[model samples]
Target: MSSSDIFIGETIGTAILILLGGGVCAAVTLKASKARNAGWLAIAFGWGFAVMTAVYIAGPLSGAHLNPAVTVALAVKDGDWSNVPTYFAGEFLGAMIGAALVWVAYYGQFQAHLTDKEIVGGPGAQSTAAKSVEAQEKGAGPVLGVFSTGPEIRHTVQNLATEIIGTVVLLLAVLTQGLNDAGNGLGVLGGLITALVVVSIGLSLGGPTGYAINPARDLGPRIVHALLPLPNKGGSDWSYAWIPVVGPLIGGALAAGIYNVAFA
Candidate 1:
């Protein structure tokens, strides 16, 4: 594919991916949304559907490598780095755009959720409440989950390991199952199978660090969250940000190495 095609395809595809995926989080987390309290199953399935939809729409144009991890894995597998930067640029840009769209779609719900003194914590908070926010700030803000992933139990080693393992599973599926066809793009059956794989990963491994197997998926929205104007949204949790970015890249490379040795 041409650079323009790859860029536009990834940009549009990843935008849809993050829109629907993050939209689920906002729906379940925000107070006013009807899907509120829909639980983890809803999120897992929602993300799977999002991936399916994005892949089908963008596959023909750019092969729909919407995640940086996927792009890196494909590059490693094909020994082709020519378009990696274009793919990465589109992925991150699309992610930020999609996240902003989510904010726009759920502006009122965000206002309601964040402005609640109970959620934001303030001078009126009990000592325990203040302590709770303090602890959360170290990893993520209350509303940050809507934009990015964070660990449930903050252990650097465990959180990084979880991301790597989840990403390896995802990349393996993509590499072996013809989901992306070695960066050529996604086929219909391959897209569906890949989406199911994502859902499976989420259900089995998402509890730890929300299974951020895609670096752009986590970091792009986190950047948007830091920049966007939201009242009392709390810290962006910069401290825990590096793991999601680094772990997924490592996982992609590792998956590609394994594929080269065994599948190639």
Candidate 2:
């Protein structure tokens, strides 16, 4: 594929990915309907499936780097560094746009469930309250709200370490499965690998802080959370944002190091 064609394919494929993956988050967390938490497992699987779909669609064209970490890892692995800048730009921009669409898709439900007055107690009390109310109203009754990485006021080292480890595992899986040519069509294997990685990270290390292993995934959606006129949206939680970026970058580099040593 030509450079332009590759860029466009990646952009569109990534946009679809974030739209579906992030959209599921909004649907479960922000939507006011009675079926709010009907599909936590489904949401997780949706993300895995989204990756599969995006890869199938754009892998041939631009390698389907929907995440910035993936782009960085590819650069590190192949040393084809010239396209790094372009790929990063496309992935991040596509993530931002996808996040915006998620906000739009769930805007009405969020507004209907959460009000301005309920969101103004302590730090992030608004988001907490909104999430609680959304659950109660939907009859899901106290579903955990979606996780977010907050300021580094507490457990900075632990959080960063968790992100690093989480991202290392994620990248390792992608390298072994995502970039592999298993001849028998590795799409399903790749999807399962991603799902298992996410589930493992969420179940084990997702206690104190949510795992934001992908920098673009966290920052892009956080940007939308800030810009969207949701009822009583809290601060974008910018303070803890850097860890996701730095941790993933470090983790991807580490994974590359390990892969090079072990496989190269």
lDDT tens digits, residue span 1-264, model 1: 789998999999999999999999999988789999999999999999999999999999999989999989988988988899999999999999999999999999999987876677876766645744875658567778999999888899999999999999999998897645545576888899999999999999999999989999999999999999998777888999999999999999999999999989
The CA lDDT at 79 in model 2 is: 81
Worst 10 residues of 2 by lDDT: 139-148
Which regions of candidate 1 fall more than 4 Å away from where they truly are?
122-132, 179-184
Clashes of 1: 1
Worst 10 residues of 1 by lDDT: 177-186
Which sections of candidate 2 miss by over 4 Å?
38-43, 116-153, 178-192
Highest lDDT scorer: 1
Assess each prediction's global lDDT (C-alpha) against the native.
0.91, 0.65
